[model samples]
Target: MEKTLSVQGMSCGHCKMSVEGALKDLDGVSAAEVNLEAGSVDVTYDSEKVTVDAMIDAIEEQGYEVS
Candidate 1:
């Protein structure tokens, strides 16, 4: 499944990398693409192996706010 999450506190390339890296590190995630200008991320993952809440937690752990 795929999801687009609205995120905040991203300001540059590193923020984009940080958000993408955190999401991609999840076991079920296949891909994570960040739109820095839009303050959002598009994530592709297996729903059976992961949950949206978990993904949100991961992003939060990286110091980002997922709404």
Candidate 2:
């Protein structure tokens, strides 16, 4: 499934990559795209292996906030 999450604290390409990398590293995540300008992250992942809450936590662990 795909999910779009509102993310904050992304100010540059590096920040975007950080969020993307975090999400991609998760077992169920197939892809992740972070838009710094829109402050959002679009991710394609397996719902059976991962949850939205886990995605939020991964983003937050990279110093970003998900709303």
Best by TM-score, which number? 1
* lDDT, candidate 2, 4-65, per-residue tens: 99998999989988999999999999999988889999999999999999999999999887
Model 1: CA > 4 A from native: none
**Clashes per model (N, Cα, C within 3 A):** 0, 0
What's the TM-score of each model vs. the native? 0.97, 0.96
lDDT of 1 by residue, 1-67 (tens): 9999999999999999998999899999999999988999999999999999999999999999989
Model 1 is weakest, by summed lDDT over 10 consecutive residues, at 16-25
